[model samples]
Target: MLEDDPFHAELVGSWLRAAGHTCTVTESGEAFIRQLGRESFDLLILDWVIPDIAGDEVLARVRTMLSDMPPVMFVTSRDSEVEIAMILRAGGDDYMVKPARKLELLARVEALGRRRSAGENDIIEAEPYRIDTAARTLFMHGEPVVLTNTEFELARYLFRNVGRMLSRGHLLESIWGRSANVNTRTVDTYLSRLRKKLSLGPETGWRLSAIYQHGYRLEHMGIRSREGAAAAE
Candidate 1:
């Protein structure tokens, strides 16, 4: 979700969680666009007004960015009939006027999500990591990396949710089944193996950072090096 207001961002994020949805919030349009360029989401929630870019402009850019456009909803302070119609005509799937009631917001979100496209290509590509979903094979820097099914799933999940803090319980239930007789230690052990096997280190431009009490997040740090170079110049 792209929201500038701190209170609204927090409230909407909590509501989305309550509806069993994972949301990543951005306070500025620049950050929002950067994230969309790298990460994929099932649905989007936008506010009409933003700091760096207008919400409507972001909606339009999202349409042009992806071959398969995901559902986008507008949650703004505007309540006018014309504004609502404009949002819809501008590629927004749903619109809710703020302050959005909990039940109503969730309902609108759920409705938009029901129409989400499930069709995905067999190949998944992120920089330096290429995943062939159909073959269950992964390549790092164009070289094949042997991975067990479980390990592959973990890697794919991490890439899919880059920068999002995933808890141990969530990882276990997601990668290993809930019924699997594995503790959080299993998660740590595998992550360590991946960190070594995938060369997830500072020099490699990526980090599988372990957060205390939280789990891990796959952070792309390539930008830091570029920023450092620019500063030196």
Candidate 2:
């Protein structure tokens, strides 16, 4: 948790601990980022207003820096509807304007768990595809489809974030790690492989579309990819 206020930090931390979860409190975004780099967390809760780095910046950095980032919740005093929309659009899973009610806060936290499960479930489903994280295997229509390790990882990440726009940098960082010498086109290449091997065309009830100027989005329905090879351009 990244909260500058002492009373609120202690209050929320104590509440989380009482609810049978471990809590680590950080007073600054720098400390928060340092801790995140050092340890894996189930959820990330932060305030919009921080002493040094703004909460939104922290979130952007997390997206670019962390490979397997967890769900994020904004617990702050910013109550404007626009701010709420901005946070959600920026990939925050939940938002609660502080001073937070104990019951409501805990309820929101648990609700995030339901939405994401924080990767707790070793097996994840995206319609016809079932990915077994423990075994690094993928099954399409209950039949095994062989994929390279990196391909399986990319497929799992794409399936996990279905309906969300993911930038190429986000994909590269998540799949290839930050220090890897992979080019951005490498992402498109791997995505093309997944498309052909898994039949990710419009016929499959899932469409992995490449958005112009943006990156990719694997949507279950309601959107279609543009025609032509320019889809990857």
CA lDDT of every candidate: 0.81, 0.84
Any residue pairs clashing in model 2, and if so which?
none
Question: Over the stretch 103-180, how does candidate 2's per-residue lDDT look in tens digits?
Answer: 999998888878775546788887678889989999999999999989998998887766666878778877897678
Tell me model 2's lDDT, rounded to 2 decimals.
0.84
- Model 1 over residues 57-128: C-alpha lDDT tens digits? 888887777655678889998899998998899888888888899999888887776665244556878768
Worst lDDT run of 10 residues, candidate 1, spans 113-122
User: How far does residue 90 in candidate 2 sit from its true spot (Å)?
Assistant: 0.6
Per-residue error (Å), model 1, residue 3: 0.2
Looking at model 2, report the run of 10 residues with the lowest lDDT sum. Answer: 221-230
Compute the lDDT for candidate 1: 0.81
Q: Name the runs in model 2 displaced over 4 angstroms.
A: 118-233
Task: Show how many residue pairs clash in every candidate, following the order shown.
Answer: 0, 0
Error of 1 at 187 (Å): 12
